[model samples]
Target: MVLAAACTALGLWQLDRRDQAAATVSTVQANYDREPIAYDPSLFDTYEESREWMPVEMTGTYDSANQRIVRNRPLNGRPGYEVLVPLRLQDGTAVVINRGWLPIGNREAGHPDEVPQAPEGEVTVTARIRPGEPVLNRSAPEGQLASIDLAGYGAQLDYPMHAAAYGLLASESPAPATTPVAPAKPAIDLGPHLSYSMQWFAFGVLLFVGFGYAVRQQYRLDHEDELDAPAPVRTRRRPSSEEEEDAILDARGL
Candidate 1:
């Protein structure tokens, strides 16, 4: 019974995970390729979960002096980092832009060999909105971040920053001669959570079914032995030696 209860709990947990994954997939499907809208300070001042993956366009100049690289970002199984440059918009407020992924360098142990530069002058950028990640306890070298914690990154900058969200680069006008590899689209696959939940549920049910089968077999075996037993037999007492002698004399006289 204890094991069955545990299995049921685990099954429900997996189902919850499946529901979350489904919601993520639905969000991506709904917003990933929608028409890009102009960046609105009012609408984007605070991060919204539903606005994630929605494309937004803006004109800004890249602030390369304060650019930073996010450490420990891997792409296609290769160790790498992501380049982040603050884009100064027309109204003086800046938004952090994640340009793309860079491979680890050979000359340096933890740094990238070369980081592709963002366009120098004012350029139009189309990017998908992504909420800022939570700060990690780990530390990184100078000019590198442990994660895309926008608030922490904003604190480092001297200008006003939109710390609520960051942009995943979609396209830029007047592209640079060389550019970092673009990030791949989010996978809409619903993973194995559903199947795993079903397996756990089946295990819980089978536990009771097996217990009942064992109980029925035990009862049958116990009753069968009792029903097949032989009945008790009666015995006559043996005659005494004197009785035997008297019976012999009587038989002769007869």
Candidate 2:
């Protein structure tokens, strides 16, 4: 029973993982299907989690003077960083744009002197809305961050930022000659998790069945022992011939 319960718990865990993966796939698909919309800063104030990954377009000027690097973002198994430059929107408020990843080649000697710079001048950016990254324990060097915590970045920039949303650059006009590749959509494949869940459940069933068989075999063995056990020996008491003769002589003498 204990073994079966453990297997069942594992099955449930796998099932939960499967569900989470499916939800992610569905969300990605939905985001891909929706038409690109204008990125209105006004809408960000009421942004919902569901709106994440929504395609958006905006016209803004990159604040090339003040750039940041989202550190430790790897690309294609290569150590890399993401360039984040604030875009000054028409409304005067700024939104951070993740310009994508650039490989950090064996920087044992120090990073490249020539950074991949964003295109200058007014540009139209086609991107997906993304939330600020969660905070972590590590502190970052100035102009470099562990994650894209836009609010934290905004605080450093001494400006009020579009608090609710940031952009992942899908493409831009007059794109930078050395622009990094755009962030790709996550693979939509519902992984082997579902099958794994089923396998776990099967294991649980098999464990229960095997346990029952073992108990049955033990019971059968005990029954067989009883059937093969030796029976109690019968005891009989009979007088010897001499004793019988003595008894008859005594009766005759009396």
Best candidate according to TM-score: 1
Worst lDDT run of 10 residues, candidate 1, spans 41-50
TM value for model 1: 0.86
Each prediction's RMSD to truth: 7.3, 7.4
Worst 10 residues of 2 by lDDT: 105-114
Model 1 whole-model lDDT (C-alpha atoms): 0.93
lDDT for position 84 in model 2: 88
In model 1, the runs with Cα more than 4 Å from the true position are 217-254
lDDT of 2 by residue, 52-161 (tens): 78888889899988898777887778777788899888888888888887777565332433467888899998888877777777976666888887667888776667
- Residue pairs of candidate 1 with colliding backbone atoms: none
Candidate achieving the largest lDDT: 1
